[model samples]
Target chain A: MNDISTWDVVRNLLDGVLWTLGLSLTAFVLGGLTGLALLFARIASTAWLRKLAKAYIEVFQGTPLLMQLFIIFFGSSLIGLELSPWLAAALGLTLFTSAYLGEIWRGCVESVPKGQWEASASLALSHFEQMRYVILPQALKIAIAPTVGFSVQVVKGTAVTSIIGFVELTKTGSMLANATYQPFLVFGLVALGYFALCYPLSVFSRRLERSAHGTRAH
Target chain B: MTYAFDFASLLEYRDILLAGTLRTLALTAIGTFFGLALGVLGAASRAWQLAPWNRVFAVYVELIRNTPFLVQLFFIFFGLPSLGVSINEWQASILAMVINLGAYSTEIIRAGIEATPRGQIEAAESLAMTRRQIFLRVVLAPALRKVWPAICSQVVIVMLGSSVCSQIAAEELTFAANFIQSRNFRAFETYFVVTGMYFLLALAIRQLMLRAGDRLIGGRRT
Candidate 1:
C-alpha cells in the first residue's frame, strides 16, 4: 500500500548489484581453482584422470546453467543437504564456471609448443615441474585475455541465480518492477548496471586479444 | 539419505515432457534461422562500415551482448506491457532468443568478414563485378565457411539458454520439469531426467548444425 520513489528503486537495485558482484567474484575465484585442477587432470599422463575430467567438463557444459542451479537448489534438500539459496547459487555457478574455464585453459595449455614439453622432459624435469615452469608460464600469456573475458560471463551468469531466489540484480529488478509498476525503468536500470559492469571487460578483452596477436606476429 | 528416488512416477507425465521438448525445439529452430539472418545483415553493415546503420548495429550488438538474456526477456515480457505494447510469453521468448543470438552471431560473422583478404576484393573489382556480387560470391560464403563452427556453438548456446524461457511461463522443457516435480513431489528425479534430456538435446543440435554447415557451406568450397 506504500509508494516507492525512483531513488528508492535505484538504491535497492544498487544493493542487488553488490550481491551480483559478490557472487561473480566468489564463483570466479573458486571456479578458477577447480578449473586449474581439472586442467591438470585433463592433461595428466594417467588415462583415467583424463577421462574423468573430460566427463565432468562435458556434463556441465552440456546441461543448461538454469537446470544446474535448480538441481542443486531443489535436489539437495531432498538428499538432506539443506542448502540455502546462497549456498546453492554459489555452488552451482562455481561448477558451471569451472567446466568452461577448464576447457578454455586446456586449449591454451595445449597450444603451447610440443617442443617445450619435450625440452623440459629431456632436462630431467618431472611432469609437475614441467607444467609449473615451462608449459603454464607460456600458456598464461594467452590465457589472461580469455579468462578476463569469461569474467563477464560469470557476472551475467549471476542473473540466473535470481531464479533460485538469490536476490541478485535481476531478481531485485523484478521485485521492484512489481512494487513500482515500472518494469521498463526498473529493468532498464538493471541492464545498465550489468552493461556498466561488463562493457569494460569486453573492451579490455578485445584489447588484450589485439595485443596478444600483435606480439605473436612480431 | 532416506529419500526414495522414484523415477517411474514421472512416466505418467511423459506427455508434458514430450510437449515441452517439442516447444523448446521449435523455439530453437525459429530462433536460429532468424537470428543468423539478422546476424548476416548486421555483420554486413559493420564489416563494410555502412555509415549510420553501422553505428546503430554497433551499439545494438554491444548492448545485447553485455547484458544478460534473462533481463532482456524480462524487459520484453514484463517491461513492454507497461508501455502499452502487449505480447504473450511465447512471442517474448522467441523475440528474446532471436535478438540475443542475433547480437552474438553478428560479432562472430563480422570476425569472418573482416578476415577477407583485400586482394580478393580487388580481384573481384577487376573482373567488373558489382559490389553486391563481390560480397556474395567472393566474401560471404567463405566468411561463413570459416566461422560456421563458431556459429554452431553459439546457436547451441542460444538453445541451452532457451531453458530460461520458463521463467516467463513459456512452457519449455524446464517448465515441464517444474510442472512435473510440483505435481509429484519428485523434484530431484524430474530435474535429473530433464537435465539429461537437455544434454542430449545439446549434443543432437551441435551434430545437426555441424552436418548442416558442411552441406550448406563446407561442400561448396571443396
Candidate 2:
C-alpha cells in the first residue's frame, strides 16, 4: 500500500525490529520470573501445586506455539474482548516461554545431586530454607548451560509472532517481498537478521555446555 | 465488547475443518516417515566419517540448523516455481518438511549412534558378523532404542511445524482457521477453536507415540 524504496522498506523493518526485541525481552524477563515460580510450584513440598504446574507445562509444551499465539490473540476477541496485537502476542509468547523456561530450570534443579538434598534435609533446615540456601546454588550451576540453550529456542520461537500480523521482522519481510517481487532478498535479509539475533545465544549455549561438562568431569 | 457469540459459522465449516485436520495428519505422517529415514542415513554417514561426504553432511546440517523454517518453506513454495518446477503447494510443503526433518533427525540419530559404545561393535565383529550385520545388530537397533524418545519429541515438533505450511495455502489446520476468520470476521473465535483442535490433536499424537515407544523400548530406560 505504500510506494517505497528497498532501503525504506528495510529501514521500516529495522524500526520494527526494536518492537520484536522489546517483545522478546519483556517475554523473557516476565516469563523467566513466572517460570521460576512455576519451577518451585512443580517441585516443592505441595503435591497439588506440583500437579497443577505440571499440567500447565504439559498444556503449553504439548500444544504448538502457533496455536498458543492464535488462542490468545484470536480466542479472546471471540468472547467479546478486544486485544491489541502487541498485547496478545506478548501474552501468548509469555505463557509459551514460561512453560519451557520452567522445565529448563526444573532440569537444572534436579541436576543438583540427591545427596545434596538429603544433606540439606538432615541439617534440620526447613524445606524453603534448604532450597533458598543449599540446593539452588548448586542447581544454578548446572542450569546455566541449558538455560542459555533454551534462550536460542526462545528467540526462534518469537518468529511465530509474525503470524499474528505484528509487523515484526518476518512480517516486514513478507510485506516487502510481496511489494518488491524479491522474495529471496527479503527473506534472506530476514533470515540473516534472525541469525544475527540467535547466533550469539547459540554460541553462548555451546560455550556454557562445554564448560559445564568440563566441570562435571572435574 | 458487543460481538455476538456464534457457533453457526463454525458448524457450517465443520466439513472443511475436518478435512483440514485429516490433511494435517497426512502431512505429519509423510514428513515423519521420510524425515526419519533421511536422518538415519545422514547420521550414519556422519558417524562413520565417510571423508568428503562427511563434510558435505556437516554443511547440510549446519545450513538447515541455522535458517528459519519459514524461509525454507518459501524457498520451496515460491522460489521453486521461479526455477521452472511447477509443484503444488502441498507437494512443496512436504518437500520442505522432508528436508527439515532429515536435518534435525540426522543430528539426533547421529548422537544416538555415537553414544553406542565401541565395545558393542567389537563384540559383534568378534562374533564373525559382517560390517552390515554388526551395524544392524549391534549399533542401529540399540541406538534407536536409546534415542527414540528424543526423536519422538522432535517428530512432534515437526508435526506442529506443519501448521506453518498453511501459509502457502495448503489446506491444513491453520489454513482452515484462516478461512473461517476471513469469511466470518471471527479472527478471534476461529483461531481459538483451531488452537483447541491442535491441542487435542497433539495430545492424541503423544498418547499414540507413547504407546508405540513403550512397545519399542520395552522396560528399557529411555
Which is the leading candidate under lDDT?
Answer: 1
lDDT of 2 by residue, A1-218 (tens): 65777788779678766776788888888899999999999997889999999999988887778878887876676675788888888888889889999998898888788998899899999989999999889888888878877776676677778887877777887888788776767776777777777777777888988987887646
- Whole-model lDDT per candidate: 0.94, 0.82
Off by over 4 Å in 2: A1-13, A78-81, B1-9, B184-189, B213-219
Q: What is the lDDT of residue B211 in candidate 2?
A: 78
- Runs with alpha carbons beyond 4 Å of true place in candidate 1: B220-222
TM-score of chain B of each: 0.96, 0.93
Best candidate, TM-score-wise?
1
- Please write out the lDDT profile of model 1 over residues B1-222, one tens digit for every residue: 488889999999999999999999999999999999999999999999999989999999999999999999999999999989999999999999999999999999999999999999999999999988998879998999989888988998898999999999999999999999899988889999999999999999999988998887775252
Find the 10 residues in a row with the least total lDDT in model 2 chain A: A72-81
Candidate 1, TM-score of its B chain: 0.96
Residues B54-137 of candidate 2 have per-residue lDDT tens digits of 788887876667666876787677666766779899898899889989998999999989999999888888889999888876
* lDDT of model 1 at position B11: 98
